[model samples]
Target: MQEMKAEIATKNSKKANLLDHNSLKHILDESVSEIVTSRGYAEDVRMSNVRLFIGTIIIVIALFAQFYKKKFPGNRDFLIGCIVLYIVFNVILQLISYTKEKNAIMFTYPPPGSVTSTGLVVSSKLPRFSDLYTLSIVSADPKSISAGKPVEFTKSVTQWFTKDGVLVEGLFWKDVGALIDDYAAVPKKKK
Candidate 1:
């Protein structure tokens, strides 16, 4: 009878162990899912911000151009040229943002190390402006590259700003990574 009782106790312990293992697995799976979803969301936010920033700059330029044209009606040709240039510049910018947005949407399940073609790097540390400029030099001048080309200048600038911002805020590397990720994952509406 004692031996039977021992056997039963061992079986119960084994069952408990199995349950614990399953529970632990479940918790781990949940944590992983949360992290992935959060990262994706952050990326989306960052992309959106990029779109907004670019859009805002284009709008500001357009407004300024309009102001200039109004202030100098005599140079109609120059004003028209400025307006055309602004429109072309913005259209190209929108196209780039659209492409990035499409890429982000297409990759619904990005692996942890999945390198984005857009050079979206999330860092918990912000580098200085000079550091950013150095990186930009290494990445090549984005401004020099045609607007239609897949350039890394914006990404370099973003990385630089992110590094600087994090340092100023005295945030941790992980927090900086999260911030950068958020910046890159900005929401973009359909063109």
Candidate 2:
């Protein structure tokens, strides 16, 4: 536990500065599509995880029904229903994932949870995933809405991921933060 805390503390200590709503908008406008693309990849991962979890639960329930058939009067019918439900659930999840993937390919106005009054309170933090680490950015403040929202962006920053991927070790945050800061510094052109 102490070791875990120490690791997390170290990661947090190395985090980049937060960019507010205007900064984020500037970055989005001027920067390449890589950030949006990364968001798509992250969404894909999130949806896959959801599918895996729910599928596992469904399978487990079906297995239980099979094993304890004598306990349930309509075991066969329940199993059939589970199979149908699983199929329907998967189809719906797939359609949703497809839509999100397609939408992510293009820039969208007023990101989810946008607010005129509060705007956005942005943050970038390194969150622990088991023994690995990921950088999570909350561009829109979930508190602005009654129901909270998930992180707006996330990317793996583990040693292997950093080594093999585009992000370099020790300078990952600097690279990403630079893009935002640089863009945010530029004056907007009059239309």
Candidate 3:
């Protein structure tokens, strides 16, 4: 309890700078495809998990229904019951996973919240980046949207990501440099 609070306090103490026009611009330019990839990745994961659950249910039904197979002889009330249970359970689990994924994406991006917090305008001036989208660095502060502050445009690199906010276990964005440098390094991957 206290330990966790102390850790969070320590994290909040770190300074995370705002991305400069070039760095932010780079992310903005590349993000059209990245958003597509992230969205698809989330969708794929959801589908795969649902498939796995379905496969497990099928196997369980097959195994259990067999023991009851001979008992019914001509009637298949047990087998029918198993199938019904599988479908009902699958629907429930699918809804749960869908809700979980939506929460994860919203927590990480918080587009609606970030825009209001940062005071960044999407007027005609910032042309290379689209007026349709908003880009923000994760804030060092847990309680507020700390991106787009003037201080962020300078050289500071301290940023904090609450794992709960990032929402997936063992995942976080460490800093603005990591954000820009990490993605920029990807083009060098081939040959």
Per-prediction TM-score, please?
Answer: 0.31, 0.34, 0.28
Candidate 1 vs. true structure, TM-score = 0.31
Cα error of candidate 2 at position 75, Å: 3.3
lDDT of 2 by residue, 1-191 (tens): 99999788566442221223333333332232345334221222444467678678767756765686455565767767777876776776677656533223232223344332222223333332232232223323246542223334344334323221222323544455544344223346699
- Residue 168 of model 1 has an lDDT of 15
Candidate 2 residue 44 Cα shift, in angstroms, is 15
Candidate 3 segments whose C-alpha is farther than 4 A from its true place: 1-58, 66-68, 71-73, 103-191
Q: Please, what is the whole-model Cα lDDT of each candidate in the order they appear?
A: 0.40, 0.42, 0.39
1 against 2, candidate with superior lDDT:
2
RMSD vs true structure, all candidates: 21.8, 13.2, 17.3
For residue 107, model 2's alpha carbon misses the true position, in angstroms, by 14
lDDT string for model 1 (1-191, tens) is: 99999787555431212223333333222332344355552233555566678788778777767677345758677678768877887887778756544322211223356443232322111133322211010111224321112212222223322321211122222433453345344356699
Q: Order the candidate numbers by lDDT, best to worst.
A: 2, 1, 3
| Clashes by residue pair, model 2 | none
Please give the distance, in angstroms, between residue 6's alpha carbon in candidate 1 and its true position after superposition: 51
lDDT of 3 by residue, 84-149 (tens): 887886786677656543212212232343233322211111233332223233222335544433
